[model samples]
Target: GSSGSSGQALASDSEEADEVPEWLREGEFVTVGAHKTGVVRYVGPADFQEGTWVGVELDLPSGKNDGSIGGKQYFRCNPGYGLLVRPSRVRRATSGPSSG
Candidate 1:
């Protein structure tokens, strides 16, 4: 079970992460990259930059950096629990809480 090729296969599986659909909007819950889950707080062009960014209030305690980028507030959240990522990096999360 501890084989190198299997690890490589797993890596490729993750590379197929689904793109964010056009209907996805801020305030929706989503998972970023592989396993970071958060609520989208802001979805627009940042003040100090061009291109769109999605500001997420991460569910994990150490999920991300503070909500500031270059010392400006793009969105607000506790330190180590905010992240700005391209919408492409996000995927829709379950709409309701898990039963288990």
Candidate 2:
């Protein structure tokens, strides 16, 4: 008889976990602008309901200049879709000190 482990082997879950990027930590900020655009915020386990990684809530700047609308909005990102902001036609916010 052949070794039972030879044909029926198991892979370690730790190896797989290592390959995945750790979720973003809370309070961490990402810059969504011309140069250093898009920041990561609220990193946590995938939402059971939405099945997404909780990300930053965007407040779009006024007018269509870069690629973002001039208003406030929310976004949810995953490994495949990246940043899925509503009104994808709009540009990202400008890089500067926020007015508020």
Cα lDDT listed for each candidate:
0.78, 0.35
RMSD (Cα, Å) of model 2: 12.7
Cα TM-score per model: 0.68, 0.25
- Per-residue CA lDDT of candidate 2, range 1-100, in tens? 7655556443565322312133233333444334333444434333232223434433443212232122322333332323322221223344468788
Score candidate 2 by lDDT. 0.35
For candidate 1, the TM-score is 0.68
* Deviating ranges (above 4 Å) for candidate 1: 1-20, 47-49, 97-100
Pairs that clash in candidate 1:
none
- Scored by lDDT, model 1 comes in at 0.78
Best prediction by lDDT: 1
Model 1, 1-100: lDDT tens digits are: 6656544333345544334567577789898888888899888877775556888999987556778888788788899999988778878897777898
TM-score of 2: 0.25
